[model samples]
Target: MIKEAIYHRPKDNFAYAYDKETLHIRLRSKKGDLTKVSLIYGDPYEWNDEGWKNSKKTMTLEGTDELFDIWFVEVKPKYKRMRYGFEIKSNENFLIYGEDGFIEKDPKNAHFYFCFPFLNENDVFNAPAWVKDTIWYQIFPERFANGNPLLNPKNTIPWGSTEPQFDTFFGGDLEGIINNIGHLTELGVNGIYLTPIFKAKSNHKYDTIDYMEIDPQFGDKKTFKKLIEVCHENNIRVMLDAVFNHSGFYFEPFQHVLEYQEKSKYRDWFHLRDIKVKALPEANYDTFAFTHLMPKLNTENEELKKYLLEVGKYWVEEFDIDGWRLDVANEVDHQFWRDFRKTVKSVKPDAYILGEVWHDSMPWLQGDQFDAVMNYPFTQAVVEYIAKDEINSEVFKHKLIKLLSNYPKNVNEYNFNLLGSHDTPRILTLCQDNKDKLKLLFLLQFSFIGSPCIYYGDEIGLTGEGDPSCRKCMVWDKDAQDTDLFTFLKKLIDLRKRYSAFGANGQFEVIESAKETNHIMYSKKTVEEQIIITINNSNSALKVHLPFDISKNESMNLWDNKPQKISEIEIEPLSFSIIKL
Candidate 1:
């Protein structure tokens, strides 16, 4: 017969109970253990400080090993939650407890931090409906400009270097961003997603060293306040890039973990495998797995989960930022996100959560984690079909149509549609600066669906490919750009804001058009308006008869206000159109 060992109860910790809910309680041993674990919980007022002594009797399950992965118990009263942990007793096992003699966290053993109730038939929706058709612009600080010469970090080690790389920091700050809101407004962008601006060791600032403060390299808190002030004034919302998955080696959170490893108060915030002692490792500490400088956060630790939730809440509540673009969201534990979402939203009801997922985000959108992802797959698909010589119009149309069909209705509306961004080549280079091709990509980009995004200089025709090249500073000189291209982008953006259909509630259809192949057309329609798009594939002008039943629906030219239309329209070689029907 197994006897129950000494234990403590948790408060409001039970996440679920049903006709017969099964509890999977996790625990660690501080003393002896060979087998068996039991759960105890109820009203502390009924059982008082003497609660554990008379804790309710539930079915006690048996198990070996020092930890309990599953221990089933019964809850007779629905909606009645109580505190609970576990106790273990055997020839060899340990029982971990808190200073209050309840359940203390053990840095040596991993624990699940994010928690949720089991799915029930009841409505489980958490997030709110957000405004669709948002227009976003990405700004790379140093590369963006020097609105203020005095605030420039240009002479600093990283910024002063002649070599243009991650180490180089240009002197862009909140002031620069605030100074540019009107510029963005004129460009017709509604939201601004700034790259990492938090205190960090790198100019790129992806590896955050501080979560609480704006990086001094960028500006101070007052500057950030001013940026927020100005952006909101112009009706442009801001989304901060939250890179909590990892931190720079010098990050204070990591430093605390290093100082005490498995023993530090902050030890539960990180992972430490086989260690020589409780102090910092003599050799440099481990990276997430050898990434070297970026230390992976251990979100699985319960103590750490509570800590991160607080950090995430602080930003939303304190700064009034619109939302967070969670970096590397896929690599982090899913539970961390579920809990993180719950906590952040609790502080701010309309807080938007966007995950950094390069692929399809169907999993995250299943009524839990994020509102949407960065839309990388869609960006690649759109770029390949329209810009690359290899992907034909037919193939591109199919991919585009299929992507729209797969995402949730609202998810598609809120998807971040970016073309040229800081990470990839400017769309100008991506399309080889081919005017016709660039126009086609732009038309589809602005009209097809989702929240449209513009790289800082994409509207002005800046050209470069990848990394250091893509990060070139924006050009304000009006005389120095491809004038025709600049005018074309401005025109499309103006049209984009004019159409309610751009919000993604419009009807859609596939017409015949061709790039590498022939016969491909993509179009959208709504009660208020209709848009027809066509791309001619061949090098020479081609006439495509309307498909068996397809006919031109527009009475007048949409984009150019061009007149003279016949039933059968001839498409210029490699040309496209946005005809209003």
Candidate 2:
């Protein structure tokens, strides 16, 4: 046995409370190293003259990645607290793995086992329950629609009149969003994630000049309120972007600092080197990504923290917005976010607080900070395999298994999964304009766990490169739109909503991943039903075999609504099938 490869911990992903009563424990061993594993656990205080009184539960092989095999088991402790250890076995070797180290046999003392001291109800990570069922559509306000062209900014070009530039605007406003609520409803998304909408000089609005006021270009507070009303009426929740990390150059306090230097009262609000604070010839003050125009805020300042926390509370208290997507959230101090969560939840207990974090965000997702982070790891894995073709099916499965094992199942359900965003190339463009590949991408995204988000106009085949370009005007012309692609996505969304097994309620399992055929098969299963999906990423047709015998059981092909009994299924090139049993 490779003792060094065995690993476990009593907190975070390895072991955590899935809910108030249940604890999910996991153990990782070198891939294919262990033949069997089981959990030996009991309340720490429960003991007898013979030894510590405990029960053993066999652990199921959850999944295997490139280097590790994950074992999982769920237990509801009789006393809500327990000490646990693993009994691992290879062909002829046996070992007891615990908090201390490898042992020849189970120790009679509970101190030798890993301890989940207590399962406190307050410690359980609780994101809003509504998030599990939501399908999010992300909208860049300036590019979506122009319902009232009268509100257009000076020099605003005609919608979709020319290629997008950094400073260009097409006059998309909240009124436009209200006018096009049908588009979202028709697309089957239940949530809309709008980019930053507070008053700012730029079209993108990430550089906030004022946190409290809505940008006039997107309409006044009344129009925004109406937009919220309309969205809520249509059963679509709204999530606005919050840019608290930095302020635009034209932000009043920033401008005051630029003018008065050392004398400005807001001097402490920002990070400054010398009092001069010149933007030209390289800025002496800290900024977001060294951009001279966007000055990073000192969130540690009490006054500034209060102001930001109020901004968080105001939207939910006043407008009844469903959520807040924090931009550059990882850059801010953790205390500020904790306070922000407290403030926001004070007004509305279930308001979703999503953070923009591109990497592992376990620190911020402990139920105290962010409810969830933008799932970029999920995005990267999908893009690498489906869009870029940089990885085969086997490697893709490995990456996804690794991602799923990183967070608690509850956190994974609310994770904001997106394919393309304002920061990356459009999905269709990334797929090299291959609609087939794009369909496969959508199939995996909507079927996998998490609250999936669709980049505006991606369903209708809007294509572009990175930022400025990715932020293109929403294509409204039905004749020109890719209706076929839109219909494909709509069906996937419908499946996600109509069946529990096809959505977040099910457990994901990798059935098979064939590198030679470049095809993969996976299943989403619940106690009542199971959904099997097969995707062929290769150009040639492929036949995928089911692992178990299903000849006697009745099965239906969810795509075409036809009954099928074959254990082997053939999938066309760049296509997929959804089978329900």
lDDT of 2 by residue, 502-573 (tens): 888889999999889888899999999999999999999888787767888888999999987988888888
- TM-score winner: 2
Estimated TM-score for each candidate: 0.73, 0.99
Error at 326, model 2, angstroms? 0.4
Candidate 1 residue spans exceeding 4 A from truth: 1-130, 154-163, 260-262, 276-290, 514-519, 546-554, 563-565
Show how many residue pairs clash in every candidate, following the order shown. Answer: 22, 0
Task: Kindly give the stretch of ten consecutive residues in candidate 1 with the minimal lDDT sum.
Answer: 107-116
| Residue 191 lDDT, candidate 2, scale 0-100 | 95
Range of the 10 consecutive residues with the lowest summed lDDT in candidate 2:
542-551
